[model samples]
Target: MGRLRRKLKKTLIETSETGLSLELRLIGQFIIFLVTIMLCISLILVATGVFKAGMKQNIALFEKELSHLSQDIYDDFGNLSLSSVSLA
Candidate 1:
């Protein structure tokens, strides 16, 4: 009877230990998953910010070129008008 009780006790301890280990493993996996999601979100935000900044810079450059082009067109028109009046 004593031997039987000892065996039962050992079995119960092993079962509890196994359950505890499994629970710990699941918790670790959950934490890792959460960290990965956070990292992905942070990276996406950083990339989007960089892209927005680059787009703004490109837009500014394009606007500057357009302004220069319009100025050149106006100057040419003025010169043409003067030459035509002088010829007439």
Candidate 2:
């Protein structure tokens, strides 16, 4: 009877320990998952802001180039007009 009781007690203790270990592992996994989600969200927000800034810079450069081109065209036209008047 003594040996039987000891065996049962040992089995019970081991089973409880195994259950606790599994619970701890599940909790750790959940925490890791939450952290990963947060990191991804942070990265996306930062990337979007960077992209917007780059696009704005590009647009400003293009506008400046277009203005310069238009000015050049106007200057050419003015030169042509002056030359024709002199010829006449």
Candidate 3:
């Protein structure tokens, strides 16, 4: 009876060790997954901010160019109108 009990106890210990090792491995995998997700989120946020700044700069440049073009058009039209009136 004593030897049988010892054997059973040894078996239980081995089983417990295997379970603990598996649990530890699962926890480690979960931690790695969480860290990877955080890294991806941070990268996406940085990319979004950079894209927004680029778009704003492009918009400003377009507005400035449009204003210059409109001014040139107005000056040309004014000069033509004045010369036509003088001729008439």
Model 2 spans with C-alpha error above 4 angstroms: 1-47
TM-score of each: 0.45, 0.43, 0.44
The segments of candidate 1 whose C-alpha lies over 4 angstroms from its true place after superposition are 1-47
The CA lDDT at 40 in model 2 is: 97
**Least well predicted 10-residue stretch by lDDT in candidate 2:** 15-24
On the 0 to 100 scale, the lDDT of residue 34 in model 1 is: 100
lDDT tens digits by residue: candidate 1, 1-88: 9999999999999978776577788999999999999999989988888647688779999999999999999999999999999999
* Backbone clash tally (model 2): 0
lDDT (10s digit) by residue, model 2, range 9-53: 999899788765777889999999999999999899888896476
lDDT digits (tens) for residues 1-88 of candidate 3: 9999999999999978776577788999999999999999989988889647688889999999999999999999999999999999
TM-score of 2: 0.43
- Residue pairs with clashing backbones, model 1: none
Which candidate's TM-score is highest? Answer: 1
Off by over 4 Å in 3: 1-47
lDDT agreement with native, every candidate: 0.92, 0.92, 0.92
